[model samples]
Target: MIFFIYQIVTKPLTSKLIRNEACPVCNTQDSLELTLYMRYIAMLIPLFGMGRRTSVICTNCGNVLKNPDSSIFAKKKYSNKVADAVKDIRQNHKRTLWQLVYPWSIWFILPFLILILLGISAINKKNTEEKAKEYAELIMHPQTGDIYKSTWFENGLSQGVLVKLMRINGDTLYVVKTKQKIQMSFSKDEWNKLSADPAAFEAKEYKIKNFSILKETNFGDLFMYNNDENGKQYPIYLGAILNSKCEMDLGFETIERKK
Candidate 1:
């Protein structure tokens, strides 16, 4: 008669019994040690029993085995679930990191660059308006204060002559006719205390009365205009105009003389 003797070892199993054993499901040889203490801890839990105690696990197939209870294969099931959850979390984390880094590294800089570009565009438009105003002032006759026009006459009959007028203030310019008015009225204190405040004062209008083109024998033809009937077309020098109440003043400086 033969008798089978079974003994429990106190020392934890260190040497692997099935070293490099390939899992039948996934054919992986990787395995980890599961000590008896860890097995006891797992077994004490209500969710784990002796049959579901810790043991070596196949890294690939996730299979588990026990010396006593292979039927209690709870560890393999739990491990597989945990592994799947971990894999999903890792994948999602990787995707999230990539998404955040990609935009911040490349696309995020666009807003600042776009703002700079918009600023440059606005500055360019302002500069262009200023230059256009300066050119218009250059083309206008300073004496007559009229825009110049070139025309051709047929049989001493000149028709369809183009007329233009331009005016400049600061960096801005306007076109006006001899019959129209551009009044500039202000108090003396206001004129003396000229400031950059845009709302400080209001502008008035003045009309152009007389305008004519004259021919000089020695010099070229001249263009002249007057704000009053008796006002002669003299070379306009710098001067200041005072209001009747002495509360307002206006200053003028000739930039050019028409010929």
Candidate 2:
């Protein structure tokens, strides 16, 4: 199939005979006829060709001869201008047909372009991972005015809390929402858990009030008054942490959640 192609095929010209002379092979009178056919191969491989062929058939003996040469053939040659014209017609079509199929070579450069695209994709993935690690270091020292956004993660931190610190009292971090003071505390254990997905950490919108921080301790005695939906309060005592920023970098964060 690689040798297949479409092309403009021109018609070949022909002649009747050498006045229907006698056959040289069978010695039959008015039986030998002559013809001139010409064609060339244009595709990768030739399907058919009658390149400069001289065909003769004897009507009386039914003998056929093709491409009979002048030296091997011992018949009286036609000695007129008509015989010379037939030879010229066959020779005109003997040149090369290579120009008809030169465009097929353009399909050879497709594989190199595909490999270049795959190399670019691998480099992009490595850059995204480095950016995620650098972003975690930016929030290492959280201040009272520092604002955080929501965390959208596929891991344990998906749809997590975000808040801006309005006040930091000792180990206590407070944010004001709806004219109410919402206090949060991050113990060593709580900090370790929250910052685990540092890349997904973010600040929350003040109008969005769905967050949770039940088992964290800052104001030691005040945590006793709060709990989950249950009437019990579970507290995680901060282990020698002076500020919420240091606690957050340790992996803990606080969010308000509805019971």
Candidate 3:
């Protein structure tokens, strides 16, 4: 359950002297003091000010005239002397600096945070695109240390495995598949662990016949292969590679598992 607690609170700000002013309610001379108050609504933080009120209280007669600047002091028209006195008091009253900044935190801080998040997201996407381009180039020119991480279906369940290139003979690519089959819901740490361990891969070599980069899409090229054992054709798309680092490449796309 979610609970929202908010309150409308009134806080006293600075007080100013209303010189030569008489309390209209008590007729007390030079006893009226003007105080400024701030009323605001708060939810976790002060949201905004409802309004400001100026009150005049007489120290001599103990009479309080709330919001004396509202045209009426005691059910009578405000005289020029009282009006000028209240105006001067209001002009002098100032709230503390903290009160000014706390209430508007959302207004200034939220947009700045949003912009920072957007900039980070844009940078991450740019890096991913750049890494994809680099991985595509690596795929075009097959290397000895190149690791091709691929996913395939096995026994009606999705499985993930890594294939490390041992060497590439003229038209054939020799590679070793990982012995441990990971679930499709794979983690980066799991991939890295398998890539770093030499014992995690198979002992024998698997040949991918007629292995060449088929320049098809702008994102990345495809590797067309003809498995010699089963005489089956399959594609290994370079775009499927999801590695941020070119050294330990991984894939999210599917490649048929060679038996």
Give the per-residue Cα lDDT of candidate 1 at 151.
22
Q: Estimate each model's TM-score.
A: 0.21, 0.25, 0.64
Residue-wise lDDT of candidate 3 within 50-143, one digit each (tens)?
A: 6666676777787766563454335634467756766776677666555555555767889999999999988777866776665555666667
Candidate with better lDDT, 2 vs 3: 3
Worst 10-residue lDDT window, candidate 3: 250-259
TM-score of 1: 0.21
Write down the RMSD of all candidates, one decimal each.
Answer: 25.2, 18.2, 6.7
Looking at candidate 2, the ten consecutive residues that score lowest on lDDT are 205-214
For model 1 the local lDDT of residue 94 reads 26
* Segments of candidate 3 deviating more than 4 angstroms: 1-5, 48-51, 60-64, 68-98, 101-122, 148-152, 184-187, 208-212, 216-240, 243-259
Per-model CA lDDT versus the true structure: 0.33, 0.40, 0.61
What's the CA RMSD of model 3 in angstroms? 6.7
Cα-lDDT of candidate 1: 0.33
**Candidate 2 deviant stretches above 4 angstroms:** 1-114, 151-163, 169-172, 176-259
- Candidate 3: lDDT of 147? 67
